[model samples]
Target: MHNWNDPGGKGSACQADKDRKDATRIAGQLNIPIHIRDFSQNYWDDVFRHFLDEYAAGRTPNPDVLCNREIKFKTFLQAAIDLGAGCIATGHYARIRKHQGHYQLLRGCDPDKDQSYFLHTLGQQQLAQACFPIGDLRKPQVRELARQAGFATYDKKDSTGVCFIGERDFRKFLAHYLPAQPGFILDTQGHPLGEHPGALYFTLGQRQGLGLGGVQGAHQAPWYVVGKNVTHNTLTVAQGDAGHWLDALRLLTSQPSWVAEKPPGKSFLCTAKTRYRQPDQSCQVQVLDDHCEVIFEQAQRAPTPGQAVVFYAEELCLGGATIEATDAAFGGLEAST
Candidate 1:
């Protein structure tokens, strides 16, 4: 479903009009019937609202994951079924296959464009009723096919990041909804280096938009966000791009949605990605009563809480969980023995 976040399209230069026009032309070309459904309220309530709440609570959340689970699959999929459609197809670059009376989600053939990372939350029912027509095709092949079809959108630039936040200053956008609570930016030694607009506005390991380039008495080394204290309204930073405090070798997650109706086992070895486009990292997972623990084979950098961590076995996407906390070991850990 297309986003209805922009009303009248004034703020974004009439992008809504252009999208509608392109969709209408394409539908006409294929002789397929199209319906215009307003899902503005749904998006605001289910996706964007939660995005704001997560940020307010001192976490960075990925809206696309929630949108795929709540709006795209749940709301839009149900709507399509009501229209007498047997199954709905979309442009998502992921594949679904049935094995032993169950459906399995797989990565797209185009590794660079694989979107199963965001689709890991989907369960058996959603996978059964969903179709990804381009899952087996590479991106260039799809683009060439579209070019052969005389479609105007064949060469459209791919959109990245959060679509609603498009090209606008993200910090400024947050300021519009969350009032700035200016606080001191302190160094690792508890020395105040400068001031920041808000601790909630930044995330761990972030080095940009900190506005600390001109601080005196600070070394020439760059600063990285290592800690955020909302209670004291303080932001603690550390110098050096390879700061030891941001290393996260283990993390905890909320309950996960598994593709096989349960985790592969009580504990299993799998490759996982903590963020989109991140290369798979070797990790060992242990399932618990209320949460799951992941121990990385190698120390991970900045596995931020509130982001989704997806598990993979070869090309199969097993499932995913929302990161709850990480052992961001400060000053490095000593040997236990």
Candidate 2:
């Protein structure tokens, strides 16, 4: 077995150390030879390129998704094949199965822990050479098995930190990498409400860390980021229980990467998740020349651009794409196409 320690440390040295120790322990227990392939420099550069590019494009990027596709399944997978391994397996909460000679990506049995959202970028070839041994078991069942085997991580808390920055102050960490262009925080009416560090630091529906409260005319309540006007360097926010600014019924996605190497059909009905662990919502899709437009049965809240929209039919994953834009409902009509 090998641990592909690709060179990259956005700022998580401790996490890397912990991961190494865990890898070592697992290798020793399984009596397998462990190899550490260092490619750290390349790893960080690749992910940073994706992160910065997306944020600069006025979109919220999921670095974990890029890391999985570029590093785990691409760089590391290739490294393993070069070392004469026929297949590679990960602890990700996802499953793979073959039906009628075509491999399909499935959600792990544990709905709460399924990671198929972040893995939708994986293609058919990658799925064919990959395995997920724990996908069939629930989190508790896996924990019980680990406890029986006396694994130190039998009850280890799942890492909820960002992939690159861990749990550090996101704005502070990002400032070191990207210049913060201070901008105006405006309401939907284009009235300036406040000032922000930068639009790149915020995402759609982000409520916390906004540092907004009781305004002169606004209500005494929390505010949410509803939009980022990249051209004008403005951040749009809205207040109230129903953040109407954050609601959307239609979204266009960048060219999707399907698990079957092609879409099922030009248009079809399926359940989709706009974010991880989000309950599936029914949607109708229409394929575009360069992207696909999805119309949710009910208006969705905060369909952030640059985040993934994973499609699923029950448990089978149909793959996903980066959200390009969303159509907000305003005055009972489309706000943005």
- The pairs that clash in candidate 1 are none
Candidate with top TM-score is 1
lDDT of candidate 1 at residue 105, scale 0 to 100: 97
lDDT of 2 by residue, 14-74 (tens): 6777888987998899899898887665666787677888887778888888888988898
TM-score of 2: 0.93
Query: What's the C-alpha lDDT at position 30 in model 2?
Result: 83
lDDT (tens digit, per residue) of candidate 1 on 19-126 = 788899999999998897877789889999999999888889999999999989999999899999888898999999999899999999999999999999999999
User: Distance from true position, residue 100, model 2, in Å?
Assistant: 0.6
Clashes of each: 0, 5
**Residue 154 lDDT, candidate 2, scale 0-100:** 92
> lDDT score, residue 138, model 1?
96
